[model samples]
Structure formats: structure tokens, C-alpha cells
Target: MKRIGQAMKRMTVLLLAAALTLDPLAAASRQEKALAETKAQLLSHIAVLASDDFEGREPGTDGESKTLRYIGKQFFDLGLVSGTNDPGHPWFAPVTVLGREPATSRATFSRKGKRVFVLQQDVLVYTSGKRALVENAPLVFVGTGKTIPSRADLAGRVALLLEAGIDGSDRQTALIQAGAAGVLTVLDGDHTLENVAGHRQRLGYALGGEELGGDLDAFIAGKALDAALAGTKLSVKALQDRAAAPDFAPLAVDLAVSLEATTRETKIHTHNFIAKLPGKRPAQGAVLLMAHWDHFGTCAQPPAEHLICNGAIDNASGVAVMIEVARRLAKSPQLDRDVYFVATTAEELGLLGAKAFAENPPIPLSRFVAAFNIDSVAIGPAGQAFSIVGQGLTPLDADIAAVAKQQKKKLLMDNRAEAFVRRQDGWELLQHDVPAVMVTSSWGDVTRVEAFLENDYHRPSDVVSPRLELGAAAEDVDFLTALVRWFADPRRVPYRSAAKPG
Candidate 1:
């Protein structure tokens, strides 16, 4: 018995030695040092992007330009092709826009009716300011602001609109292209309504004048609108009649909005950085991994507008994840098809940058297989599994499930309910019929994510460290990295879901 006890002690000592020397299994294929690097990379990138210097990082601002340039420089150094740089440098894809520039002086904005009200309370216009008058500022009240050229007579009329479903469901772009003059827009309330195009993003005050520290036009929500119209002294119908024509003469029905502040009609140019890692097959399909780099640079107001919306968790974290994930793929073996890592801009302005990328894709849109989007890893505790907000609605669900298995995380599909899978750059891809999913957490429903976002989403409170849990984000990075590997190197592209579309 004493001999056996001595043998057991020796076994324990050997086990202790192994424990002291051998490394533990890591969630990621990358080692501790590499993981540390990734974590540090994420933290560092987020810290800078979410820093106060970038303000909210809105596009067209000095901060956004700086941010894009930084990302571009990093991509260039990472062995990626130069996508259109300043002059002669060739880019994989040049960032471009087809929009009017803002003006330096006040704009003359008015509609054809006294009672119709073309003023701020009833109208919202984003002008290039160089032009004093928006030709034919006629007010055609389309029911909800959805359908145009079919349900309503939209040719040669300025649209006075409410949210979708209020009049008819009309696409805003179609209305503008159909030769509608200055548009009059009404607030869509909040997310609770979910009315036609009732996106809460429209409520953001990060407009041109707002961010530039210039006075933005606003209506006092109550008597101000009434007082403006009381001065019109013209009938709504008579004003509408006067407004009808290719070029109608100006009448008393015209109302102009004047904000007492210096305006600049300067041209705004910004770009999104793209890095390509070619794959083996080169033709079957491609999976996109994306994140937005722009944030709320500056507010239309301070203290009240919360100044800078640093957007640490709002996006810098997501962009950092993209960089880390890209680095991993860069080091891995060839994939079946191409994988593109895109860091977008102007996402805060309605996913404009992403939309532009989609409309003019680097590859065939039909060949675009899937999109995996990361947006601010605000929750999702480590060792605790989570779900894709829009799981099972696409082919990616099975892949995510397989990932959950590899991660040992018990995944849930319908946990976030209404919020699941409806946001981030992935959702934009989903709209174009590409299979896509977004992973994020506004800290579950119980947490202060909503309030936090309300107060800090675009505010300086969005800074890194104090605003985020690096450990929690690390777990997400691991799970996501593994999933991306599986996605690009799958034996077969995952099958689409049998479920109906949302």
C-alpha cells in the first residue's frame, strides 16, 4: 500500500509538470500570442475610430476623410491592391457618389400652398445650397410616400410626403428621379411604429448643417408652423393650381426656409476601403465580410445633440473584427471562391456606402453567395452561445449552427425577435437577395443598450474600454473567425432554408 501511494504521488507530480508546460486548447486556431494580437488590434482600432477626434466620424467631414485614409493606408500595406487613391494610384474599386453638393448660402425653399405648408414642420430638404431655388417647388401630397409614377401623378411635382403607408408606398429615389422638386418630409416617429419607411435612422440629427456646427433649419413642433402658414393667406388648392406646370410662375404659395447662419456649398468626397483575397475556384461564388468605418462625426448640436457619437461599439468594434478576420484569412489556405473584406462608410446615413457597393459590385451579384456582417459586439457573454438575428431564413443558418457546435455554444435562433437580423451591412445585402446575416447584441432587452444608445450611440460615451468588454468581444471574434473559415472552405455551399422569406 505504501508503494502504491508513492506511485500516485509521482503521477500527480508528472501531471503538474505537464499542466505547467503544455498550452490549453484555444477557441481560435490562432495561438495565444496571435489571439492577443487580434484582441489588441481590435481594441486599438476601436479606440482610435471611436475617439473624440473623429467626432461621430460622419462621411464628408475631415474626421471621416482621415478615417478612410487611415484604413486605406492599412489596406495598402497589407498587400491588398490600391483601390483608387488620390491621383495615379489604381484602386480595386474607386469610391464614388452621384449626388448634389451642399451650398454655402441660405436656400430659397417654398411650396405652392399657404395651408399646404412647405416650411420646416412640414418639409425637410437636403440641398446643394448653390441653387437658391429648387425649380418648380410644387407640393404634391403623396399619401404615405411609397408608390410614385403609378398610384399618384408624380411627373413634374415636388412631393410633400409622410412616412410610407400614410399616402401610398413610394420609393424616395423614384420620386426624385421622376422630376419632383424639393421634398417635404414628416417625421416617422420611432421604431415602435414600423410604418412605411418609418426607419428610426431618419430621426438622426447628423445632417450637413447639424454636424458642421452651423444652424440647421427646424420647426418648433407646435405654434411655429401655424404662424408660418397664417402669413400665407392663400388657399391650399389655389396654391396647388399655381404650382402645376413645367415651369410655373411664383405665387404667394411659395414658402422659403431661412436659417440665420453661414452656409458652405462645398463639395464633399469620401471613400470606403476594400481589400480582396483571391480564392481557388474564382468563379462559383464569393462571400462578403463587411463592417462600416464611419460614425457620427459631430452632432447638429452639442450637449443637447451629445456632440460626438464616437461609435465605439456602434461600429469601430465591428470594423476591428473585420480587420482581424481579414488577417486570419490572409494567412490561411486558398478558399473555393473569392472573399472580400469591405470597410464601408456613411452607414450612419442609411447604408449609402454599402448600397453603392452592392449596386456596382466587384463581382457578379448573382454569384455573391453570402454576407457575414459584424456590428458592435455589445453583448453575447463568453462561453454562452448566441444566434444570428435572422437565422434559418437563409443558407447561412446551417453554417452558423455548425459553427455553434464547433464553439460549444448553445445557439438560439429567434431570441432577438423583431431586432434579429434586420440591421447592419448584412441586412443591406439580404435586401439584394444575397444570403446574409448580422451578429450583434444591444445587450439583450434587459440591459441599457437602448438607453445607452440613445445617450451614447453617437455620443463621445461610445469610446472604447469603458464602453465595451474586450473579453466578451474576443469570444465573438473567435466564433466568427471559425465560422468564416468554415464558410469559405465548405465541402459544398450550404443549402438554402425551406422557410418562407420575411
Candidate 2:
């Protein structure tokens, strides 16, 4: 009896050891080789959608209608639900934004203790957020501000931050977070004084500030002005020396923030085309995927040399990849939760599509498990597999990494850099507290952003190019498939407890 027991124990130990040892082959299978017919179906769809015949798929036009219907038909044919289905099915989300040209804004800031009026060159507009109005009133001087999630000092006043000082406060973020009347920031960020442009045009969109009025048409310029000093004192040189000091703190002034801005009255409608993949035991949560389908709408060129602004690669490729992923997933296997595939419109117009989608979605916003966005994967082989932007989100990275291993593709995150979490559509999701990630290769890279813009972006030549590579696209589709499968699986949910250091 003792000898028999000993033999069984040794056998059990041996089996466990072998199992651990056998775990090395990052298992990879060309499973698509089996789904060839499906691949053909998808490729044919992409070809037509990307061809010049589609006129670049711009929104609010005939081309947009044709493109939407075609992709919608593809979704229907694939058996996945439309994201707009009132219930757990197909759907369309209508989004809108205020589109208007800004009038020249002429305003003056009188620095406290200074008799000379400051240059308007110090301000810029931070126009990327919920649109609202800036009424005529005296802007209050709120010291270093406070925020919602974190308590910033700027509770209710317009932050009057000194040009180059770090007042132990993040002025811009704080003012916006605290909901100040409006932010009138100068070039106080960590920029070199020597590089400062002498002339400031209103507030450039790049800098984080806003025009006193939201979108009023007015004439303006930043001509030097004289101010009547009341309190202590300061001359232009003194003000310059103070504003230029890195630690300078903005002194409060009895300044009136009198500017006028009102809503456009008629709202601009943006859209988010949504699709769904129903899962088995869909845990109250869902797997979300977002892709922006809007590109620069039309080209402003002479008729003889003009053609539609074809956004074939800027977004047709992304839309194609997402559509294929939805199709492939519909047939392969089922998951525990629903999968939402969204193709947001007007992304080219300041991420209006993504912004609108996040504001109000068809599915219960809170039930979302995580978000995966496939932006631009024009090429790959950069690392082992393609590159993933915004892999910084803990839970998102874990799933992408695991799936990368399964596909025998490197879960390469360290080798690349993409402010992607904050750059494209992914950032919109991140703000809503959803764990989101964007998977892309070179096309997804930062250097590639301007590169694409320089060549095909918003240009007529953006149609499917002979030099374009579609093979890498297939790989992207495959990666997305694997990622969705990993997340939707009941027990294999994709949220990490901690973020791995790069």
C-alpha cells in the first residue's frame, strides 16, 4: 500500500512540472487562413469604400451617406447588432457641435502694480471642451486654482497667474477644472523666454486659454496701451521683469472681464455610428471599441485642380480595420458581455464624434468594460507586433499584452512613444474614467501624424495609394480580434490592478 501511494505522488509531481515547462511557445495560428471567404468579403468592402468612387467619405454629403450605408450593410451581413439598437442591438447616435469662425478679439489685461498695459501676445485659447458662453462681466482674480477630482485653489475666480511663475499651482488645468469664468493665460508654461513670439494673435488654439467671447465676429489687435495706475506702482520694464520671472505670481487687479459670446442658436450635429457583438453571460459590463470615421470634410481648391478631399488612409483604413474586426468576431466565438463598435463622425473637427459619443452613448455608459480604438496602422514590424498607443492604462495593457503573447506578437510597449492617451480619440474615453487603449503601428506614431497630414491628410490624393500596404492592416485586424476575444471572455476580463512601469 505504501509503495503504491509513493508512485502516485511522484507521477503527480512529474505531470505538474511538465505542464509548466510546456508553456513556452507564444502560441500563434494563422486562423484567418480558415476564414478566407470572410477575408475576401471584407477586402472587397474595403476596396470599394477606399476607392475614389466614394469621394473620400466626408460627413454631411452624398459620399458620407454611401459610405455609411455600405458599412452598415456590412455590419448587418456579418450578423452583429447595430450600435444604435435601443435595446442590445444596432444603432446610430446623433451628435452636434457649434461650428463658427472666431472674430478678432481685442482685450487688455492690466497687471496689478503696473501702469503699462501687458502685451496680449501672452494669451491663447483652450477651446477643446464642452462649448458654452462667455458673457460680459468683470473677470475676477482667482489665485492659484483648485479642481474637482483634486481640490485646486482656484474655486471660483478667473485665475490671474503671472506670466512665467510657478505659483505652486497648475494655473491652466486648475482654472479649467475649477470652472473659472474664462482663462486668460500668458506664456507662463515651461517655455523659453527667448522663443516667445513678440506678437500674440488673440489666443492661438495651441495655448490653453479662451477668447472672452465664445465665437463672436469682431475686429481686433494687440497694440500697446497705457493704463491708469491706482494702487502701488510698476512701469513696463518692471512688469516685464515680473512677468518674465519664472516664480512670478499674478497680482489681483480690479479688472472687468467684459466680452460677449453666445451659442450659435442652431447646433452642429455630429454622429457616432455604433455596432454591437452580443456575448454569452455578458457581465453587467461591456467591451467598447471606438474608431473615428470623419476626415476633413471637403477640399478648398480651385475647380480645375480640385477633387474631393479623400480621407482613404486618414480614416478609411481605420474604419476598414474596425469593420473587419466586428465581422471576424461575430463568427468566431462568443463572449460573456456585449461588444460595442463605434465609428464616430466629425473626429476631424476637434474630436467632435468621440466627444459626442462619450457625452451620451447608446449603451449604458457605466456598463462599459474598457475601450479599444484602432486609429492608424499604416505599417508595422516596428517591434515584434504592431504598436499600441495609450497602453498606459493598467487594465487595458494587461489584456493587450496577454493577447500579444497568444498571437506570438510582442506586447511591445516600451520601445514606442505616443502621447496617444492624450492625442486622438482614445483621450476622450480616458477622461470618462474608462480604461481605453489605441493599437496602431507607424501610422499611429507621432512622427507619422504630421507625415500623413503633409501628404494624404485632407488632400485629394488621399485615395487608396498603390504604395499603401494592406497586409499590415490585416495584422491589425487580427490583433483587435484577439484583444476583443480576450476581454469578452467571462473569466478573462481585461483590467489590470496596477500599471507596469515602461
* Per-residue lDDT over 1-502 for candidate 2, one digit per residue giving the tens place of the 0 to 100 score: 8999999999999998787666554212234453344345445655677666676676666777777787788788888876686563346666655544333334444443332354444333323222334533333333223212222333333544334232213555445555555554333345432333222222222111223233221111211211322243543335446655666554544554333332222244445678888887654478888877766555656653746666666677778888888877888867777998888877676666776677767655666767887765553322334667766664667667778778787555663545445667878877877677777554434565666667766677766555565556666777788887777765776323224211
Please report, in order, the local distance difference test score of every candidate based on alpha carbons: 0.57, 0.58
Please provide, for model 1 over 432-481, each residue's C-alpha lDDT reduced to its tens digit, 9 standing for 90 to 100.
88777764433333254455556666656676665476555666677666
Best by TM-score: 2
Residue 71 shift from truth in candidate 2, angstroms: 1.4
Please list the residue runs of candidate 1 whose C-alpha ends up more than 4 Å from where it truly belongs after superposition: 1-38, 53-56, 76-92, 96-266, 300-307, 378-380, 415-417, 420-423, 440-448, 494-502
Output the number of the lDDT-best candidate. 2
- Please report the TM-score between candidate 2 and the true structure: 0.68
